[model samples]
Target: MGDILIVDDERDIRELVADILEDEGYTCRKAANSGECMAEVEKEPPSLMILDIWLKDSDMDGIDILKIAKRDYPGMPVIIISGHGNIEIAVAAIKQGAYDYIEKPFNIDQLMVVIGRAMETSRLRRENVELRRRDVEPPELIGNSPAFRTLKSSLEKVTKSNGRVMLTGPAGSGKELAARYIHANSGRAEHPFVTVGAAAIEPERMEEVLFGRESPERGIEPGLLEQADNGVLFFDEVADMPLGTQSKILRVLVDQTFTRVGGTEKVRVDIRVISSTNRDLTQLAADGIFRQELFHRLAVVPIDVPSLDDRREDIPELASFFLQMFNRQQGLPLRTLSEEATTLLQTTIWPGNIRQLKNMMERVLILSGGKGEIAAAELPGPDAAPADDQGRVVLSGSLATLPLREARELFEREYLLTQINRFGGNISRTASFVGMERSALHRKLKSLGVVTSSKQGARIAHLDEQPAG
Candidate 1:
């Protein structure tokens, strides 16, 4: 049992949790609203704080309170209780410093489980944060491989000019990070930098978000490319852009001018386009999937982001950085990974690459029992818990006995394909189910050349002759 604070405008909710935790042998404090929440924390901060995002008449929303508490008491763990919104806000909350969030009308057991995990995670983050540093430097291309060195030399040459640049890489290979480095290394580091992951957005309003548009429907304004004038317009997963948006982008790439959506007047902006994707744009063009002209315009100097497997040497540095990040975030006793854990970390095939590794570290930081060191069991399994599908099963096995990286890749390819089959190849459903955007998934399919069931003919014929990832 730990000291906890329950903050909500609803008396029933506050009372229910206060009563429950108290009965469970925890010292529980109740706050009828945010004012009381502020007052209560000031009185004596608890080990954990449970926050409800919305309330009947609270002075502050949960996100607001979360920011306050996170800033005021960086060590305090906050578990958000979202009533109306979904996990988008929850993920946003996490990015903004909330420990974790439970949906409204949560099962008591699940809430308790999340709470416990959040507390532990908070403790561990605080313990290991010193090992990691918030990335703020210009892209320092760090690799010794000849392939990487050639990439570095290419980057240097590109940074000398302001041409439309396109980058290619597998998912989680750090395209965006590389884009930023390009901006930072370029002469326009002082200008506004904007990024758009086209696949993450809905196709219906893609134009409005990208080019510029007036929408009475959403009371929205013009788009970002105009806003990023004199700077870079980074189109992430460019191959995922809708056909209409792709045409418009192609026009811009060619002429650096475009008529604002819903307007007749053509607007001109001095913007450098930096497009990145994991897909083969040429193949996409040939397959009638993307605009060939756009490919030629953006791919003037194409660069590839190296996968984590290719940079095994960077694992220790990256892990050290994450450990320190969790140390500050979790507030647990400072600890380091044992040699066994370190060895396991290096060998695992990161199908999801760096992004997966980061989440894995977070999971481990939370699951570890406050021990200074993290063990293999404490880490997240190879796969992320499928977000949109309940039946999704992570391909699991012994990490030590298997070739970690190759096994992970095999598992992911199969898992993603399985999800695709389950969703009947509805890319959006599959992407959401797998916690990515439709465009990203499209790019993945384009990059991997994964087969649909109809095309899997001979491969699916035997039932066991599936594509080896």
Candidate 2:
């Protein structure tokens, strides 16, 4: 049950392979030039590609396409076919990542055998990727509120189709988790689920990272698009992707295929894209930072995840869920929150949404030793400043002895770290509050040697106590 694409400039050859392969119980498709071949591949990558060495009226020759295909879909098998085959060209093709070579007047039995072998290789590689993939527990939405109910209903509809989804929400509002939930319930659940942070990838290397790269000597290095073939690709912070890269991604969304970096062959992929961003994409588009057309394509089925404050009724359930989950994972004793503490949690402004609550619970569990009920008095709050006995800000060492630039750097780092920790490592929230661009904030954090927590373990340090009456 494999799909095979046969690429040959000659009409006779195209028909012959299509007829032969279809008779052999494999789904067969044919293309006349390099463009057609790549178009088919990008729309829905075949298990194997049979390519000609010299493609007439094509942008690139067979060997060139082979290298690009191999790079974009490393596990995909390609068999080189040539009427003008020689030892030198065959050896070169093999070196450039072809699985095997076939001569123009080849035996039917031999070609079928090679096709079977190549299909088997592709199957085995995909199986290996699946086997090595981590079996992570799906994140729970954990809410009984009206807003949550509507969200669940909408998600169910979205999962039934293969439409591109745009998730817009505040940081730590479970956009990635919602995307995962949709993937888990979709038809492609058995396939790979790859995630890429658009902001994290540098603009210079963004193409190579997302679309992959090809080299005659190095073969092909598959990109995230190929890796997410037949499954889901979640792009976190998609608004931060460079404008040029956004255009390339738009092409992929439009045609379901892309050419790799330094290669002319189009690599096809069958992936459902789900992009998320905490920023206002519309505003960014108006400001000319983000592409408006790309935004529209990504927002075909926009879903806005509610902030924690909007769904306060679900706080108790979420808190208890996280408490139990942490207990099991950390091997801590069972714990419960006191009534006063629970009330305080529900009333406070959860700036970092569910993520902040999870962080607070983790901190509380650790601080309370996890054996008994957690009291309101023991909880830590958002503020992160150490004051002296005279109520003055405390500075480590002697600031006056240091140079102005060095002192300023130290203060900036401290301030950013404090705000980041207070917001439970929510970069978007911190950026907005600090009046800095999110990308700029990221650069600053990287330069300052600050590594933020992963989305799964994002934490907001809590206050000492709240006015829980």
Candidate 3:
């Protein structure tokens, strides 16, 4: 829908192509050499480029321009045209990322067809990204407590604008969920809503995963930035992102462009960023662990998600919601929480917030064993021993009277469960705390016959599948 730049040294040839394209209802621009071509592109990237592989009296040739364009503006389709085209040159152009190659004396009809196909191909790629994003169900922001209502009101107000948002909250407090809610409600709802788990991805592969990589061996793998074009890019636990990557992300925020990991050309994107963090970014920035400029850019519309402790009144509703969700998802029988059981849930300390509550509800439903009403006695009790200032639970129980094997099993189960609860049911953190591999911990839990709902089992299986560090 934008201008198409035709690059060639010869005045007549450039004018002819421009005139034909103009007649075909495409706005046309002309560039006589590589320098002019790049200038025009930098000024305003055209939807497509018609490039000449040979340029006379120009500091750089058409092939050089093609390389730069493909590297930087990878999404923009480029058609290489050469007057003295050969098989090798054509192959080279295509390998360098050109959409197609056309020899001199090109057929007018064929040229139009290629142009149409190239533009359509680009459009379809974007549409595919959006479609894939739509396949993911948006997370619901459920709750009617004053804390939750105020949070929803703030989210509704911010969704009307394109301001960058930074969600601050404790782990599992629904920051990522809040970010998704904003994206799903925003004007860019129809586009992709890509998430980058800052802590989940290994540091070595972070750049490649975020900015993508392009090489002859690897071909082209678009990064999260490109996939999130015209949509939202949510950074989960942004404080976990490395400082070096933080600076690069900051540059992208400032310039709206970035080069891939193995690329030299800049890839421009239109994206709205929403980042969430459980850590104190202000203190981190002051300590130089996080970039101050980047933090300010991300926190333009800072919003704090209330912890589960702050909204205990929502527990009964939230518990019921999770119970129904798990039942429907797993095709299990309907179950209800007794008033006493509900009261117990409300009184318990939910260190993991909504996610912990959800997991606990799933466990309760699984353990209910077809009972229509879950009892207070069925629920797992809150932490047995008060955690010291260092968060280490000191158990005050004796297994001296029990047999060795029985005592060992009981101790292991209690210790593991306590540690798991301490870390808010994050298996990875719990594994790290207990000095066990994630898979090993899962196997241990299974061997101990610790009952887990299907959803928790799936999550454990997913964690087990990841390669060990």
Candidate 4:
């Protein structure tokens, strides 16, 4: 339920409106004069305020309250009501922070429309507040490997500026999560961190989602960028955005102002942007699939996330972390990874990075479903080949056979392919079984150029496979 305050000197009008608002699912609180209204406002701010222009007191007007609320509260929305409404006064009221004005001898339908619009705005505002609260609750960014440490330090710098960021990484490398850390740590932490993942959103309708639509019946509303004013707009899978959209978004980056889809007047904003893409954008630009200028604009401080296999040593820690997390979430015993499981986890190449490790532990827990002493047989698949005492792969081949990095890469690629096939190319199930984020797994498949298409979504079945026809 929403908290709403109604202020009017007319007793009949006050009761009638309060009863009507209560019926409409609003928690209605009433005040007979401006004095009481201000007192109620100070006690605790209501979600929406319904104020009558005329009052018993002669000192101030309802428009004065709207101006005061707007100036002090900044984003709070207010609706004005009056028996003395006219076109000129309505326009003036709007200019003075009145969200909308309604004529008294109130039409309940029209009032509902105005209230609905006000409530929507309030809800978005409240959510933005809660999001900011959650963001500031401290660093949830986990990891300590050199790669992770490097990324973490870079993030501190990224959060210190209004500069745009281009997060380039394989899927599930926590690019979005990293972006959140940036925002949460930034000056815009109190503002919204709105996200629109380009790959997740269909290409054909990207415009509507970003800018928004306007039907005559629905009224002219703001878009995502506008909603994110004084905040950050995080675009995930920005590489998947169509070339035309890239140019359009580039224009917004250059000039922080845009008209709504069917609008004429420019709606300006002061916002920061942080975007991510798993694809090689420079190559995409070279191939004419992405705009070079747009890439140049967005890559103000580019962050490249190393693949999971690149940070093999961090696996044991990440696995234990995920296990601890799951243990708490599932309210189960504090289960430790077996020496076998730890070695198995360490030796396997994580195509999906930390996201992959998390998934693996979850599968172990689910398979164990909170049972004791997880064994290699309890694992979803066969033990690592040429197993160590812990059942993890122990490479017997000489380092001379392949460079250390190359051998590691080969091992990880082969291991991921085997797991994918073992799971029948089911990305989510494989992710759960292996311990990785599903998007990270999908990204791993894409980066590995693995292709396994079913009637459902496609995935990488082999690291050496090509993109689909």
Q: Which pairs of residues have clashing backbones in candidate 3? A: 72-265, 72-266
Per-residue lDDT for 36-116 in model 3, tens only? 888999999888999998898898987888888888988889998888998888878878888888999899899998897
* Candidate 3, run of 10 with poorest lDDT: 452-461
Clashes of each: 32, 11, 2, 11
Please provide, for model 1 over 58-138, each residue's C-alpha lDDT reduced to its tens digit, 9 standing for 90 to 100: 778888888888889988888888678675786777766766667778889988766765565444344324212322445
Question: What lDDT does each candidate get?
Answer: 0.71, 0.81, 0.81, 0.75
* lDDT by residue (tens digit), candidate 4, 1-469: 7889998989888899889888878898899887898889999898889888878763678888888888887677788989988877787777786778888888988988778767765665665567666665654877555567778889888788899899988987888788899888888887878876577555665775577655433356566787788989988888888887788788888888776777667778898988898898899999999999988988989998766654554666777777788777786566777767665665565677677677877877776765555665665443344667886766656734998887876666666665654343466776887799999887776656666533222334443356554
Q: Relative to the unseen true structure, what is the Cα RMSD of model 1?
A: 17.3
lDDT: worst 10-residue window of model 4 = 454-463
Please report the TM-score between candidate 4 and the true structure: 0.56
**For every candidate, C-alpha RMSD to the true structure in Å:** 17.3, 17.7, 18.2, 12.7
* Residues 248-346 of candidate 2: C-alpha lDDT, one tens digit per residue: 899999999999999998898999999999999999999999999999999999998988866666787898999899888897667888877775676
Which ranges in model 1 have alpha carbons more than 4 Å from their true place?
1-150, 214-220, 328-334, 380-469
Candidate 3 regions off by >4 Å? 1-138, 384-469
